[model samples]
Target: MTQTTQTDRTTTGAIPVPARTGVHELDPAEAQSAREVALRLVATAGAVVDDEKWISAAAAAWQELPLSLRHAVRAFRRHSGSRGTLLLRGLPVAVDELPATPGHGSSVQRRATVPAALIMAVASGLGDPIAFAPEKSGAMVQDVVPVAGREEFQGNAGSVRLSYHNENAFHPHRPDYVLLICLRPDHDRIAGTSTACVREVLPLLSPAGREALHAAEFTTAAPPSFGAGGERAGAHAVLTGPASDPDLRVDLAATRPLTARAERALSELADVFETVGRTEVLTTGDLVIVDNRVAVHGRSRFTPRYDGSDRWLQRTFVAADLRRSRSHRADDGHVLI
Candidate 1:
């Protein structure tokens, strides 16, 4: 793909260079403070790591971070430019004796580890941590690794190029943000996480295409991880909010158009993504937070050996407001049942 020049003004329906990806490199003191907070939370929650009480306690502890660090997070949360993705580097994570990639097995026992605790602390700063009842048996933190027999599957268990998607787009209560922390990178370090935002590509769309996207003529089916409830989202618009700067919600892998015009519009959107998307290769101690409402994310193809040392990334989801899904959960719990 050819690269477009960086400019605020549009030139013949082309996408300008997007605002750079948001990245914050933690200083030694800030990294140490984060480690201390994670350790304190681990000590506080002795037996149960996923307990709602314990998670809430961790969020409260996260609020006590230094004002400068807190301000940076707040600013990113409110306005992360056109990319809608943020990467935090140099966070302290204990990875010694880390278990091999679990494939499709249980991750319950791994939740009590120091890395998991650290993820919770950082995720809480963005929003309330959440989980889907059907994914990984409702575990808040999930392991993203290639499975033994599911290499071609489109979901997290595959090494194939996973198409761009808004996390959990088939559900009524999709996450507002998605977090992925790297403990071990792919063996060859060739895997890349791809992200694209409508804000960066809106100018590239024709008026007819934009009009078709705003109409409710598309549907997205839930991924296999969601189990029996993996049905299609009915009659939804791909774009919403202001016409000048719209929000996006469409899974290129699972979504389908109801009409020929909608199909053409969807293809145009994909073309823009191919030209404007940014890809990143995450390494150890790197945490990436994606604004799900504004950006769509996907993964590139990589060879996973499954030799207990393959690519391993821990993922967690968050919602800006938990109360919206109050009725879907029981007793104000974190998981949506």
Candidate 2:
């Protein structure tokens, strides 16, 4: 892993991509082991996906296990967690064959790939998982990669200039983890996903700045992408919750700090974001899990080629538990109907 430190203003906004070493790469055995564990956890999550009652029962049974098992269970979850992002190359890909159109209505569908079961399994391995899709949550993991019928590259969505961000940063229901499972790469394969650890940047701020970060000196709002159009919102406190286990609230475009100290901490936060964020390209069968609380994630720009096989990735949101967003979901672990 590469260590990160703050530099003068001249170096801000640039996160260097480090050369890969042997340890960060996963081999077949480790990949398979991860898959099997995810399968077990998903089967154990008590979810009614695909009308499979046994899987639901399986998930429930695992939940009954000893508490000590949780940590070990996550071993099968994310291997390198200090950075809060783990990369695995081989989990089963649901749509092994090409689809009639990227948006076909089957397991072989193109734009949206990856089995929902696997996502649930990974969530159980983490803590709690749920869908933001309305059909599942009211929001589909909306294909930003491939538009199914069209061959355009949809890596992150829209024409907006995307920067590092904590997804759903303001909402009380933000997921603790964001998993991106890749099925196809853009024609060029040059696009890279970027991420940075808050731990790395926390030390860059002045003592007073750090204090402001700990208090309710700031406010953030939903980005324009989530229908926040024409109107803007604000957030108080750059963060809330425990220091050890915290929930971050920030928006690069919308975040506002009340004092100079709070402003400095926010600046330090952005500096750390660009300094430490390591960009990793996603290839076929590559699955990356991001710790939403500890790190912010986004991607670099890639032009789409409107061909049949554009970049395709399956995205799923896991909250770690439904209680975190009780105002948005109903019981039985399903989103509000």
Candidate 3:
């Protein structure tokens, strides 16, 4: 299909993606095997490698999978999301062994070892090829981190924080999709993944609340993960209504309202999250995809063991095709925009 730029894309039903085939869940056995290999690689390394290195390794590992199973996953990737969301039953997450995050002295790109190729495949399989562009000098997750956040956070095997949020509300162009590959979960931790669809909650808003959200500006900042020095972040309208494809921008941690009307909209938005979002506890070897355009995602608060195998999930982002925002992408084929 020719690239869709500035086109009307909203419908009454869950905003659908013609490219999205259908939801396909992974098999437990397949997920476990990937976890096993990842754990061993991490155990050998002793520290987290960089995202690029791990991505390269994962692509290789996935390419090496048995033909039948490999073919199945390749098929699954195509039909996963509606322009955005796709869920993989497993993605090799384990609590016993995981790569360590490289400290300041070393390159994180070398430490981010991944066990399964599903993540690489999913991003590439669904929207576009995975962009290993490090957001910061040496960042981990990809998609240019088009948006950044600065919340002090950690996820235990079980304990985790899944606060509902849009990945990069501060940016001018947000991603069409958000992909997560699970490597481990705190067995004793109960942190859950939280997600909310704007479509699901739009009906609950009062007319005035809706209008306030449609206004053109509100403050938003990077999540603590990228350490956006609170001030470096900027503001954006919480929502901009269009006849089709209404643009929604939000971040629980950084978004600030300028007027009481905006505040009311924010409150209504919060209520929608509480009353209309989806919550699922991500387990070891699972992969979760979010429609960055249709839904916001976060983790429920949980404690981390800080042990070698605390709940660790490898994250990556994908923009539909970099064609629309070529100017901002890193030369390395990754979207820095």
**Candidate whose lDDT is highest:** 1
lDDT per residue for candidate 1 within 1-337, as digits (tens), equals 1345433234664633333448877788988887787777778845355787778876887786554556666676788678888888887875675777676633543346666776777778888899988788888788888887788888888899998999988788999989898888899998888999888989899999999999999999988777655678999999988999888989998889999999999999999998889899988888888899889999999998878888888888988899999998988899998
**lDDT score of residue 295 within candidate 3:** 76
In order, what lDDT does every prediction score? Answer: 0.82, 0.57, 0.55
Show pairs that collide, candidate 1. Answer: none
- RMSD per model, one decimal: 9.6, 11.7, 10.0
Alpha-carbon RMSD, candidate 2: 11.7
User: Which parts of model 3 are misplaced by more than 4 Å?
Assistant: 1-23, 28-84, 92-116, 129-162, 228-235, 241-245, 335-337
Candidate 3 lDDT tens digits, 53-93: 55455544555443434544455444332223455564554
- Residue-level lDDT of model 2, residues 257-286, one tens digit each, is 777788888888788688777888787677
- Candidate 1 residues lying further than 4 Å off, grouped into runs, are 1-21, 105-110
Clashes (candidate 2)? 25
Candidate closest to the true structure, highest TM-score:
1
Name the candidate, 1 or 3, with the larger TM-score value.
Answer: 1
Q: Write down the TM-score of every candidate.
A: 0.90, 0.69, 0.68
